[model samples]
Target: ADLPTALRLRRGAQALGGMLGPGLCGVVLAGAGLRAAMVMSLFLFGLATLAAWRVGSAQRPAETTARRGWFDEMADGLRAKWRVRLDRWWTLVGALMMMCLLPATGLLLPLRIQGLGLSAAWFGACSAAMSLGLLAGVAGLAPALIERVGRVRALAVAVQACAVAIAGIGLVRWAPGLVALFAVIGLALAVTQLVGQTHRMLAMPDDYRSRMSSAHLAIAHLAAALAPALGGALLGVATVPTGYLLLGAGFAASGLLLMAVPGLALFLRQDHEGARGWYDRHYPQAFTRS
Candidate 1:
């Protein structure tokens, strides 16, 4: 779609221009260990910061159409959204799943670094590798797997694979091996996110897409917000190893339990007969097909 193309172009330009240039300069400076280089780097960053602030101030609109604050706009949007009224059950389930699994990501890498005694740089590289693995899976591998196995089975396989990675993180003691394990985890996480989102989108009516997407992002953020707090609490009582193992086990069990729910099949089943029967009895369509 045009959306993807535009996004890719924008990202490519930004990455090539800003990120890559700064990154190269930082690496060159760090390698030199020269005081002047460090000072120059800091000066350049300060200049960049000032420029950004000036640019931001320049871009502010001259006038406002509505006097409403952001929170007011959000409240109005929620009230108007179709997904708030429709697909309530599915949205709740999706939110809960996101709450549990998404937070596990932040905990995983820090624990890998601290508990496993790997360098912080290794964590960054592992994160990138995981993202690449996910990118490869999404480009074509996931859909093909779903086609061969069907959605439900594919979901189960992805979760189970994720559990394997989580368990691997817990059970493996060696530091070097974690790089490979994290890559697997990343692959599983990527596929799981893509497939799960696709299923949710397909389950709802077209009118609900915007609200559901909003709900999805909100839930993900909520999960992220809770991660550090929960991780800190766990870290207080147990060693980092124990904390990671418990997190890993919890992730596996939650996925397994969700997959086993009785009504989940009905929610995911690719048929309208159930909806049709329910609609005919309780809330009939406004008009019939000619």
Candidate 2:
């Protein structure tokens, strides 16, 4: 729990940054030319790089007696993930969730804006709405909901709600309605991200956290790249409403899929406190002060 608190805090910072960065960037871009904007961006990127390097350098390397081949080490990471039942399930679930959101927001909504013949400012407004929703999820909604319900139920509900929200985006023709839809999608993403991430860290042993996280991120990025293509294909084949409805159905199915996860089954049966109590019984010594 404590180790994952660092992750939770990171998530909160990310949400805040997402909410702030775009508007700030737009202001800079408007006031200065592209050249000045690029220079500012470069400076910020360099600062972020230095911060990341410093954090990485602070962590002491773990001591290991046995040497393993590169393939074996990689395979070991996969096997370790499989051994952690919840992590294993989430590895699949989280990927699908990641895949769905990006395409829906990136391609689908912008497409909607274009179809409506709206200005670039409308797209920007929709994007910012989603970012604000994400901020709420990480800073407000996710914590409150997760604390009241367990992560499992919260995620399942969020997944389905996200699906509905995505579908809503396509159904609406108005800019204001589209912005609201995008906001809901963003909120759902935040809920899934924070709750799912805590589960990710909790499910895997500390030794395997880095490796598992690396694998998950690689897969998510690949899925992200593929998702827009898939969205484009859907748009080509069907009208936006049908495409979005089908996409929403797919996302809804992922929530149903969660019911099959054994660890989540336990969570569904308990409130947050009961869930923690159950964890204490299973891992008394491993329990953090939470």
lDDT of candidate 2 at residue 164, scale 0 to 100: 93
Best-performing candidate as measured by TM-score: 2
| CA lDDT scores, all candidates in order | 0.56, 0.72
| Residue 272, model 1, lDDT | 33
TM-score of 1: 0.64
Pairs clashing in candidate 1? none
lDDT (tens digit, per residue) of candidate 2 on 1-290: 46556776777687677767777778887899778888988999999999888874446554561465666655656665555565567667766766666777788776778888898778778878888888788777888997888777787788888989988877888889888887888888888877655554555455555566676667778888888888888989998777888788777887777667767666544533344434334433432221
lDDT of 1 by residue, 1-290 (tens): 13323433443344234324434455665687557567767897899799778864324342431475656445433443322323344444444545444445566567657766666666555555555556555555766776778667777788777767766766777766666776676566555655455444444343333444565566557767776777778768977666667766776776777676545555445433333333223322311212
Q: TM-score for every candidate vs. truth?
A: 0.64, 0.84
Residue 246 in model 1: shift from native, Å?
0.9
